[model samples]
Target chain A: MNKHPHIRIDRYALVRNTVFVWLTAVVVAGFLVNIPRINILEHTARNLYFHVPMWFTMMAAVGVSGYHSLRLLQTGSLIRDIRAMQAARVGAWFGVLGLLTGIIWSKFTWYVGTDVWWNFDPRQTMASLQLLIYGAYFVLRSALDDPDRRARIAAVYNLFAATTTPFLLYVIPRQLQSLHPGAEGNPAFSDITEPVMRLIFYPAIIGFIGLFWVLYTQRVRTAWIKYRVIRDPEL
Target chain B: MEQEVQSIQDSLRAKESISTPFDSIWTGADVPTVDPSALEQVMLSNDKLYVVLAVVLLIWFGFIFFVYRTDRRLSQVERTLEDRIYERDDEV
Candidate 1:
């Protein structure tokens, strides 16, 4: 049996089980706990536990992807390249989820009377742009025939993409006038947030990030196997 | 010690019994007899808790779908290797 030192299945089972239990508890607590309803927000405030975590998980995934990319630049390890690519792909999914969920939330809350599902909210636009950058990274990879050359070029582009992620998701969105809560005023976690909601909110973020880790690890292991058998790691 | 515990429980009960203005307003409101819109009927019921359920389920199913796709890839690789093994046996 050909064994790769980096790709181990032992840790995944334990971590996957833990993440499953943690997220289940998060869901129960998220629904069962009662939050103080405010005007406009109403019960949609429950979204605080779900919608916000998608961004947090995506940001964490970006950090993981960038770290692996930097390692690839240093060592030129194929494993590092595979890890970087898988992380970015999974992270992009999280960003897509965040955008879609935000649309659904706004449709009910802000666009109640109007039929506008895709208002050009600053955060929404910036996030979509960020996903596009990652999309270009994948396109750039596919355009290259040589694996070594592709990994090097994609790593450089991924580093640039990672650097822009924070600016696009947080900084630029805040500078512009927007309906997202934190943009115009104090950050979302201010005096108004209830202590009870925080109980589930923080766990939800951790659980979703944990979920990201599991998915990224799974893809990396599969890519490693394909790399060994078929000599192609692109997945 | 038993008496002390009983007293603490009694105080908690007393706290629950004390009604505030918030409780009064919530209790005094009439249940709506008018028909709710379809969206409201599905999403806004039970304090709009179903919305949270919807979001959670979407994420849950999304992750499940990813796992299934990855499993399929693994199965494909396994089949390819198995085919190669059969070809080697036939040659022998």
Candidate 2:
């Protein structure tokens, strides 16, 4: 009835359209723009534009989710709780996509002529572990029935989950031996990655993160509407 | 199709002759090597470009699925709103 004071639908529409066009351009450039092919990587080096962005988007989602969870703790606002929950849900989906795409990329590129689909590469394993941590966050939310109690407890758990994400996705993976580019003793993006690839890669990251914002915000809006009508925000 | 497959195989063989930094990492003594299966053969073709295609498609599908789920939530909220309106009309 109050026109949903917190959300500006017009602004959301503008962002949604921008993300749609931006990502379409990214996908086109991602394939059309050529780079110097390497021995194992070859054209699959283009995966830097697609596969890597999933992780970056997931990281951004985690940051958004964590910030909202922190606010939920401080403000005791149900809207913040809804936002934090939706962010984590969407973020986890991105992580799952990242993991699956990584598996596919490695299957053809790294594990070619081999029977391996999953060899437990350090980064791959740690990424899956990070997803499981977010998985626990969802399960924890479902366990609590009272909205306020659920919000408080889930926010605390989400913060803990967010804290582990950096370590699991970046720190631990870099510390261990990994086929992933940024591992210890490996030539990272700065050294081996081509400038042409970076041209598409960075934009791909921004576009995917923007896309995440669109999806997450849409879910939050729907959940907020449910809260206004039914007094429950879980969707 | 056969010629295309042959060209891909020739290119793959040619690539094996030249050593790069990745070769050292991927072909380490500890690494196990085996024959590629049919699925691997298809994916490994065209400089493994199909792998990039697969990755992109997977992400696209993932987003589509998420969108569908959000639409479902919207429908549920709309139904609830409709029910509430009907209840108020009855009260009136």
**Each model's lDDT:** 0.82, 0.83
TM-scores for every predicted model: 0.76, 0.76
Indicate the docking level reached by candidate 1: incorrect
Poorly placed runs, candidate 2 (over 4 Å): A232-235, B1-92
Query: Which candidate has the highest lDDT of all?
Result: 2
What proportion of the real contacts between chains A and B does each prediction keep?
Answer: 0.19, 0.06
Model 1: per-residue lDDT, tens digit, A1-235? 4344685556776787788889888887888777897888887888888899999999999999999999999999989999999999999999999999999999988888897998898989999999999999999999998878999999999999999999999999888888887786645666668999988999999999999998898888788776766573322
Best by DockQ: 1
Q: What lDDT tens digits, residue by residue, belong to model 1 across residues B1-92?
A: 44644544454355455567643124334533344455655575464577877887788768766775775677577567657756776887
Model 1, residue pairs in steric clash: none
Tens digit per residue, CA lDDT, model 2, B1-92: 65765665565555565568755223323322444567877787555666876797678767756765665667576667767767777887
User: What lDDT does candidate 1 reach at residue A29?
Assistant: 80
